[model samples]
Target: MNARPLPSLNILTGTEVQERLIQARALQAAFKKEWKRLVETIAKTETPFQSIGTHEYAEELAVREVEQETKAIEGKAQRLEEITNGSIASLKKDRQRVGFMRSKSSVLTVGSNLSKDAGLMASLGVWADDFEALWSVQKARAASEALQEQLDKTKEKFKQVGKKYREIKFKNQLLSANIKLVENQCKELEKYRAHETRCKSKTERLEKSKALL
Candidate 1:
C-alpha cells in the first residue's frame, strides 16, 4: 500500500514544529531502547544447539525475529531522515527571506532620512532662485510624509520578519537535534544487523555439519 504523503515543513507553525520534534525524540528513544534489548537478547541466546531438536528451531526463530525488527528500524530511520531534510530546507528559505526584508527595511530608512533633509532644505529657500520657495517646500513636505509612512510600514514588517526568523532558528535547532538522534540510532541498528548476519552464517554452518553427520 502507498504511504500517506508527508506534510510540508514550510506550512508548520512553531508549535507544530515543537510537537513534531517531541514525537520524533520519543520515537527515537523508544527505538534505541528496543534495539539495545534486542542486541542483549541475541547475545544471551545460546548458539551451540545443544538440544538438537528444539535448539535448531529456536535458533531459526530468533534469527527471523531479529531480521524483522531490523527491517522495521531501518524503515523508521528513512522516514526520520526525510522529515529532517524537509525541515532544514524550509528553515533555510525562511532565513533568506527574513534577511532580504531586513536589508530592504534598512534601505527604506535611509531613503526616509534623505527625503526629510530635502524638505528642510526647501523650507529654508535653498532653491528659491530657480523655483517658488513655497511650492518647493510643499512638494518636499509631501514627499517626506510619503517616505516616512513607507519607512514606518517597512519597520513594522522588519520587526515581524525578525520575530519569525528567531522562531525558525529555534525550530531548526530542534530538528538538528532530532536528526542527530535518528542518525545515531541508524548506526547502532547497522551494527546489530552486521552481528545478526554473522549469527545467521554460523547457524548455516552448523546446519550443514549436522546434515553431513
Candidate 2:
C-alpha cells in the first residue's frame, strides 16, 4: 500500500495541512470506538467447553471469532504505526528543506514560511496521536489475551471436577449392586436355617412315640 511516494510538504499550504490534521484526528476517534468495541467483545466472549456436554460448537466458534478479530486489530495497529512513522519522517524532511531555503534566501519571509512550519508541526502532532491510538489498541489486546488465559484455566478446572463427579457416580452404583447381592444371599441362608429346625423337631417326636410303645 505504501509503495507510492507521498506528496512532499512543499506543495501543501498551512490550511491544507490543517485539513489533513482534522482527518487524522477523526481517524483516531474511529480507532478509539473500535477499541471500545473490541474490549466489549472480548469481555462477552465465552470459552470452549464452558458448558457440560453441550454447545461445544457454538463456544468454539465464538472463541475463533475473538481470535480472528484480535489478529485483525493487531494488524491494523502495526500498519498504522508504520504509516505514522513515514508521515513523521516526511514532515522532518520538509522542515529541513525549508531550513535550507531560509539560510540561502535573503528575504526570509515569515508569514507563509512560518505558517508552513507550524503546519508541519501540527501534522507531526496528529501523527503522534495516531501512534498513541494504535498503542492503546495493542495494550487492550494484550489484556484481552491475559483474561482469556485465566478463563481457560477455569474451564480446565471445571472439566477436572466433572470427571471426578462421574467417577464418584460410578462407584456409588457399584456399591449399590454389592448391597443388593448381599441381601439376596442372606435370604437363602435364612431358608436353610428353617429347614434344619424342622428336621430336629421330627427326630424328637419319633423318639417320644417309640418310648410310649
Where does candidate 1 clash, by residue pair? none
Instruction: Indicate the worst ten consecutive residues by lDDT in candidate 1.
Output: 47-56
Candidate 2: the clashing residue pairs are: none
- Compared with the true structure, what per-residue lDDT tens digits does model 2 show for residues 1-213? 112222232233445545554655555455445444433443454533222222224345445544555565566656656665665566566666656655645454557877777766865765666566556556655665665565566556445544544554455455455545544445554555566577667767777777788
The model with the greatest lDDT is 2
TM values, all candidates: 0.31, 0.45
In candidate 2, which residue ranges exceed 4 Å CA deviation? 1-113
Predictions in order: lDDT: 0.51, 0.52
All-Cα superposition RMSD per candidate: 31.4, 33.4
